[model samples]
Every structure is written in structure tokens, then in C-alpha cells.
Target: MLPWLLCALLGVLVLALLGKVCALTRSMEEICDQLADRLAGDTNNLLTLSTRDPHARRLAARLNVQLRLLRQQRRRYLNGDRELKEAVTNLSHDLRTPLTALCGYLDLLDRQETSPAVARYLDQIRSRAEAMKALTEEIFRYSLLAARESWDWEDVTLNQVLEESLLAHYGALTQRGITPQLDLTEVPVHRRLDRKAVSRVLANLLSNALKYSAGDLRVALTPAGEITFSNTAPGLTPVMVGRLFDRFYTVETGRTATGLGLAIAKLLTEAMGGTIQADYRGETLTLTLRFPPAEEKAAPRAVPGGGGVE
Candidate 1:
């Protein structure tokens, strides 16, 4: 009887040891599975241990907090990288125009002659220089707008703005022998906008149209106070249309275009709660400009006699 009792006690001790070993094995397997899952995860690879496991749960919570912070940092880094790339692209495009012009002017000046050809070359140089100046100014203006700053708005007349822009480009239009087709109806078209900014937008659009148009420049104002500028051109592709408002995107013309004109215009327009769009079909390019209607007190002035030149 004494021997049987000792054997029974030994058996009980062995069973208790086996239960502890089984529990340890199960815990180890769980930990290994969690580690594998975390390793396989693409992002935020913090393991989530069961709440019953106090030590593992605490570790997982700490890891999760760190992972979230890492994700936020990574997003910021990527965003900054993308913006830097865009800025570089814009800078390259802007620089290319002036560089091309400078080269052409230098080549012409190198020639030994005092003839009409030399005069033409000088004229080309002057034109290119002016274009470069305009491009620089436009870039500066866009930078100001992109700084996320606000401007004071006042009531401005749409017709007056259009007229001023037209007057500014009158000389160039006359030189090109393109008639100004003004289709303005008798209406009071006013909107709350920054006058100087809106003027720049219109000027940029008209300048681009005059530069590219082969013939027939039409400037039409609708009764609803919307403005439309259309010109005869070789038309634009779908790709060009899509990128019309993108910075440093120009048409496929071999001519020296800084490609920032339309981009600046678009930015200023949006800043003023207005919209601008392009419609191209065959050999025609039309730009539609829309804004809030003007106050009744701000009516358009009568068209001047002889269409006063700039």
C-alpha cells in the first residue's frame, strides 16, 4: 500500500509538469505567428497581441503608436518630394524660353551687316526680351497667389476690364491686321474681384490668342456678363487641352513660349471665384470666361470712336 501511494504521488507531479510545458509551447507558437504576420505586413507592421497577454499587449500598443507616427512622417516626406519635382520642372521650362531667345539674339548680333536683316534681328531680340519679361512677371504673380494669401476685393466692371485689356493689346492687333470683333451687348456686368488681378488674367489670355491666331480674333461678351475670346488656330489636341492649366505646359509649337501664361490666368481666375476654359474644334480655339454678374450701377462704357489704340 505504501509503494502504490508513492507511485500515485509521482504520477500527479508528472501531470502538473506536462500541463505547464503545454501552456509554454502554446504561448511560444502564438508569439511566432504574430511575428510572422508583422514581418509580412507592408506598412505599419505592429503586432496586436491578445488583451489576456498583458506583457505582449503593452509591447504591441507601444509599437502601434510608433507605427502611426512613422506613417504620418512618410506621407509628409512623399508630398514634399512631389512638390519639389514639380517646382524643378516649372523652373526648367521657364528658363528654356529665355535661353532660346538669348541664343537666337546672340547669333543674329554676331553677323557683320547693317541692313534690313539686322533690323529684323534686332526687332526679334526686343520681342523675345519683352516675352521673357512678361514670363518672369507672370511667374512672380503666380508665386504670390500660390502663397495662399488673400486679397481685398472690390466691385469691378467686366466690360471695363475687357476694354482695358483690349486697349493694351490694340497696337499688336493692328500690326497683325486682325480686326477686333467686339460682340458686347448693352448690359451691366459687374462682379466682386480684384481689378488688377482680373486685368492681368484677361491680358494674358488675349496675348496668347493674338500670338497663336492665324486670322480673325473675336472678342464677344454675352448678356449674362460672360466673356468669350475665340481665334483661328491649328487647334489643340486632347492632351494639350488637358494640360492647358498646368504650369510650364505649352503647345507643340517650335516658337519660344514660356508656357506659364495660361497657368497664371487660371490661378488668378480661380482666386477670384471665376472660371476659365478652352474649347477647340478643328482650326478654332475659343476661351470662355465666366464670373458673377456685375452690379447695376457698374454699367459698361460706350465703345470709343476709332477703337482707341494703345
Candidate 2:
């Protein structure tokens, strides 16, 4: 009888140990799920395990320490980002007033009649002043746009916007002696986009082409919402092409390159749930932009009538 009782007590002890381990395993799984949820969402709560198992408790303690540190670092980064944005906004505002006054004076000077030498000097002054004014405006606009988290959206027909932008730069293109080859789809390619933002993006691309094109400029729009702007850019290196959309990055070959054009285009494109990319190959640089069709809109079924202008 004694031997039987001892054997029964040993079995009971083993079962208790197994139960404890299973409890620990379940507790650990719960802790992992809670941690994953905290990471995915905005929660930063510390992990707490109900099990008194040493291993489970230790893991929970370690995770809680790391979580607290991560939250602190994230908070610090957000604060710094906000501060920098505010500074840029203030600086843009400060520069605009003086820039306006300077442009006013330059206009006044341009109106005054003078000798040929004086006239030449005034013209140079006017050109430089105009460039400065343009740069100032772009900077101010960039700061404002960067600070904005959302955009005012609308239904924008890209073909019409493209035509308008091209026409606006027609004089510049003509002066440069470059006839743009345009292949536009006849069927209206409609997108739910910010008209002003898309217009600015097109204008920037056209302006960049005017500055860099070595005789050839090609622009095409497809029914799939893809827009391509291709031009011969002999001056750009592979490295430069890679950083084409980086903010305030200018290269020696680009005259009057503020480096903000592509950056602004990228910012606005991303904000509108679109993408813009640059490709460089054998003296040619191509910029491609696309906007994903809106979810609620049906796929466009209109037949495409494509045309090209030399």
C-alpha cells in the first residue's frame, strides 16, 4: 500500500508541472499578440503577463523596457519634424515681403529710359531679379505645401491640363527652337486629382524639358493614366539623374535649376496617391508619372484616339 501511494504522489507532481508549463506557453502567446497589436496601432502600453513563470515574466519585463524606449524616440522625432516645418514656414514668409519689394523696384527701373549701356545693365538686372523672384515664390510655395497634410481634391482631366500647360510654355519652347512631340490620347483620361497640383506638376516637367532638351522633347499620355515626358539631357550624369527629385539638389549643367521642381512634383504626386519616377539612358532622361484610378470610379471604356504633334 505504501509503495502504491508514493507512486500516485509522483504522478500528481508530474501532472502539476505539465499544467504549469502549458499555462506559461499560453501566457507567452498572449503577450506576443498584444505586442504585435501595439506596434501596428498607435498604442504604446507595456506588456503584462499573468503567468508567474520566471521566463515569461522576464520576457514581459524586457519587452516593456524596449517599448518605453521606442515610444520616447518616436516622440522626439515627431517634435523635431514639427519644429523644422514651422521654421521653414516662417522663413518663407519673411523672404516674400522683401522679394516683392525688390521686384517692384526692378519694374520701376525697367520703365525708365536710358543709354544703350545703361539699358543693357538694366536688362541684366531685370533678368537676375526675375529669377530671384521666381525662386522665392517656389520656396514659399514648397514650404506651404510641405506643411499641409491633406490636399483639396477634384476631378481633373489630365489631357486638358497638359494642353494648357504646354500652351503656356509655347513661347519658351519656340524661342528654344524645339518643337515638342506630343502623343495625347483623344479619350478623356479622367482622375480624381487636385487640378492645381497636377497643373503645377506638368508645368514643372515642361520647364525642366525646356532647360535641358537637346532638340528632342516627347510627351505622351496613355489611357492607363501614365504620363511620360522624355527629353535629351546630355549634361546629366547617372548620379544626378538618381537624385533628380531630391529637394534643393542642383547640378552644374542645369541653368536656373532651383532643384525644387522635381521635388515639389514628387511631394504633390505622393500626396495625391500617385507616383513619379525618372529614368536616364544614353543622353536621354525620361520622367514618368501615374495616378491610380479612384476606387469608386469604373474603368474607362472610351476608345483611345491618339495623336502626335511634331
Candidate 3:
């Protein structure tokens, strides 16, 4: 009697175990179906395959991390592509304006009857052509500055460069009747910068000052080597000041300037490890260019002379 009872109990235990095994198998199948659906819908999905197993959970976590990285990379790629397209469009439009102007000027110069008036017209055409050429060169320089590549730096004298730039623009300043007050110190200050880049920046600033300033223009170089160019022009509003360094932003009067001068100046200054800022105070527009301090090992001695525009 005892043996028979034990056999019945063992058979009942075996049946219960079999039932649990079958239930687990069904659960696994459902989990697999769900996983397959998710994978088919989106390869980027992070959900794990259906299973009551620890291994699936670990795999899903690892896969989620990889998916996140891939998504970030994809987003960056899309953004870069969009920016490239926009840059190309802007380049095309800017180039078209100058090229069209050149074509029209050439056509005018090719006409019959070369009278004095015709000669004057030809001179005007030539001037416009030169302006267009300068515009193209500036655009190219701006593009180069905008690129992510680095530039070669050399030790250059800031005071000397400033003097040379001012001298070069002396004729234009005289023609425009704008007197430049130079407050330069005789101290020779050395800075690690690209010479060409610094010259371009000064040229742009001086050109803009001559073009826009209706009154006195003051360029002061401090003992600490902070150079400020201030012109007595109409005060700019806060909004205009905010966008003053922006590309293609002309003033309220719709000036004929290409509006890239200040923007390029700011960019090159920064690239050469310097800083630039624009401020409007008391009926004057001031643009400041600050260079990094000279290295301690360098010897600086003489105080520079004061020169005014003739």
C-alpha cells in the first residue's frame, strides 16, 4: 500500500513539471514574435527579444548604447549636409551680382563713338570692375577664414602693423575729409599673429570708418596695446550694435558697402588669438581691437611718436 501511494505522488510531480515547461516554451515564443516585429519595424529600436532570460536583457542594454551613438552621428551628418547646401547657395548669389556687373560694364565699354563722355563712362566702368574684383577677393578671404582649418602664426609687431595700415589709408582718408587722430605709444609690442590677417582687419576697419564717419575719426593705441578706432558717426541703437558684426547687415541708410568688412575683421582677429568689440557711446561708434600680452622674455623699450592726419 505504501509503495503504490509513493508512485502516484511521483507521477503527479512529473506532470506538474511538464506543464510548467510547456508554459515557459509558449512565453518564449511570444517574446520572440514581439522581438521579430520590433526588428522588422525599425532596426534602430532598442527593445530586447522576448525571453525570461538574463542574457537577452544584457544584450538589449548593450545594443541601446550603440544605437544612441549611431543616432547622434546620423544627426550630425544631416546637419552638416544642410549647412553645406546653404553655404553653396549664398556663394552662388554673391558671385552672381559681381559677375553681372562686370558683364554690363564690358558691354558698355565695347560701344561705338569714343567721345570724352564715353571715356568718362569707360573710367567709371573700370572703377566698378575693380570694385567687383575686390569684392570677389574679400569673399574668398572670408570663406578661407570660415573654414575649420588652422592658419600659420608668426610673431609680428602690432604697433608697426597699425602704423603701416594707417599710412596706406592716408590717401583715402584725405579724399574723404576724415582726419585720423593717432594716439599710438612708442612701445614695440609683439604678438603671435598672422601678419596678413591683422593687416586685413585694420584695413577693413579704417575703410569702414572713412566711408561712414561724417566727423572726426580717432585711433588710439594704449600702453597695454589695446587699439581702439572710434568715429564720430550717428549713434547706433542697441539692436544695430548687436547685429553690427553680422554678415550682409547694412545700416538703416542702405549704404552701398558690402557689409562684410566688420564681420571679416572680427573673424580674423579671433583666429589670430585676439578679440574685437563694437560699442556706441555719446554720439561715437568705437571698435576696439585687443591683442594678447607680449611674452615676458621679449624686450620692449621705445615709446612711439604721435602723428596726426595731414
Candidate 4:
């Protein structure tokens, strides 16, 4: 009877040890899950566990302290960023009023006749004023874009928009003695994107091409909804190509451009759940954009019946 009693006590101790270990394991999993949720979401919840394990409780307490510190830093960063963008927008807007007045005076001067030398000097001043005006306007546009909070997403007919953007720039391309080559897909490709944002993105890219293309431009849209804009840029390096989408980045020849074109495109494209990339290959520069397809199909929006380099 004594031996049987000792065996029963030992069995009970073993079972209790197993139960404690299982409880600890569960507590660790709970802490892990809560920690992940806290990181991904903006919430005030802390790690909560079922068991009263001293070690796990201490671990959760330490993590909660760290999370509080992290949240504080994140808040500070966001506030600073928001304030910077607002300041830029305000400054750019203020400069526009004076710039407009300066340009008005310059135009008035252009009308008055003078000697060839005086006229030549006036022309140089006028050109500088115009360039400043352009830079100011581009800065304004970029600042506005940077401070934008959201865009309305909808089903957009991808091919039609591309055609319209190309046609819009037709006159400019022709004036530069270059014809844009377009190979848009016949099949109607649709995507879920912000229409106005998409238009702005394409406009910026085409403008970039106009500013930098050696002598030709080619635009193509695949059936799968990939859009590519390719041109021969005579002196672009791999490093320049890599930073093409960076904010306020421009090449020596592209001084007239504010360098915000592709940056804004990238910002809006990624915001709309799209991808934009630039590649420089053997003197040719190519920009590609891919937008996710819509879950629900919609009819193509009406567009003018002409496409093919306008």
C-alpha cells in the first residue's frame, strides 16, 4: 500500500509539470500575436496572457514599454513631415503672385520697341523670368501633390487614357520634330485606379520625354495592362536613371524641368496601388507602369476614335 501511494504522488507531480509547461507555451504564443498586431495597427492594446507565469509577464511588460516609445517616435516623425509639406505649399503659393506680376511687366516690355542691343538684353531677361516662372509653377504643383491626403479610386479604361495623354502631347512632339510611336492594345484593358491621378502621372511622364528625348518617343500598352514609354536619351547614365524618380532630381540638360515630374508620378502611382519603374539600356530610356486589374469589370469609357501618334 505504501509503494502504491508513492507512485500515485509521483504521477500527480509529473502531470502538474506538464500542465505548467503547456501554459507557458500558450502564453508565449499570445504575446507574439499581440506584439505583431500592435506593430501593424494603431491601437492602444497591450499584450495580455492567460497564464500567471512570472517570466512571461515580465517580458510583456518590457515589450509594452518599448511599444510606447516606438509610438511616440512615429507620431513625432509624421507630424514633422506633415508640417514640412505644408510650409512648402504655402511658400510656393506666395511666390506665384510676384512671379505673375513680374511676367506681366516683362510682357509689357516685350511689346515696346527698342534698339537691337536693348531688345536682345530684354529678351534675355524675359527668358530668365519665364524659366523662373516655370520653376515656381512646377514647385507649386509638386508641393500640392506632396500634401495631398487621398485620391478617389475607380475603374479606369487604361488604353483610352493612354491614347488621350499621347494625343494631348501630339503638338509638342511634332514641334520638336519627332513623331511618337504608339502601339496600344486593341483589347480593352481596365484597372482600378484614380483617373485624375493616372492622367497626371502620364502627363508628367510624357512631359519628361519631351524634355529629354533625343529625337523619338515610343509608347506601348500591352494586353495585360502594362504601359511603356521609351525614348533615346543621349547622355543618361545608370546612376541618373536609378534616381530619375527621386524628388527634385534633374540632369544638366534638363535644367528647365523641376525634376518633380517622375517623383510625383511615383508618389501617385504607388498610392493608387500601381508600380512605376525606369530602365536605361544602350542609350534608350524606358519607363514602365503597371496597375492592378479591377475585381469587377466595367465597360470602357468613351474616347475619341483616333490613336497612333495622333
lDDT of 4 by residue, 1-310 (tens): 9999999999999999999899989998998888999997778887888888899899999999999999999888778877876787788889889989998988898789889999999888878878787878877777666665555667789999998998898999999988988898899998877788889899999999999899999999998888999999988999999999998889988867777789878877766667899999999999999875754333222111110110
Taking all chains together, each candidate's TM-score versus the true structure is 0.56, 0.75, 0.61, 0.85
Model 2: CA > 4 A from native: 1-37, 46-57, 106-128, 186-188, 294-310
In candidate 4, stretches whose alpha carbon ends up further than 4 angstroms from where it belongs are: 1-21, 113-115, 294-310
lDDT of 3 by residue, 153-235 (tens): 67888899999999999988999887788899898887876788788889989987876687689999876768999987774
| Global lDDT scores for all candidate models | 0.71, 0.81, 0.71, 0.83
Give the number of colliding residue pairs in candidate 3. 2
TM-score of 4: 0.85
**Clashing residue pairs in candidate 1 (N, C-alpha, C atoms within 3 angstroms):** 190-294
Q: Single out the weakest 10-residue window by summed lDDT for candidate 3.
A: 301-310
Summarize candidate 1's per-residue lDDT along 1-310 as a digit string, tens digits: 9999999999999999997666556655666787666554446556554435555556667766766786788778767855754584478467767767776766677575668887786778767776776566556545545543445478887888898899989999999988889998678677877787788788889888877788689998876768899888875675677787788778876256778788878777765666789888886888898875544333322111100101
Which scores better on lDDT, 3 or 4? 4
> What is the TM-score (0 to 1) of candidate 3?
0.61
- Model 3 segments more than 4 A misplaced: 1-110, 113-137, 294-310
Winner by lDDT: 4
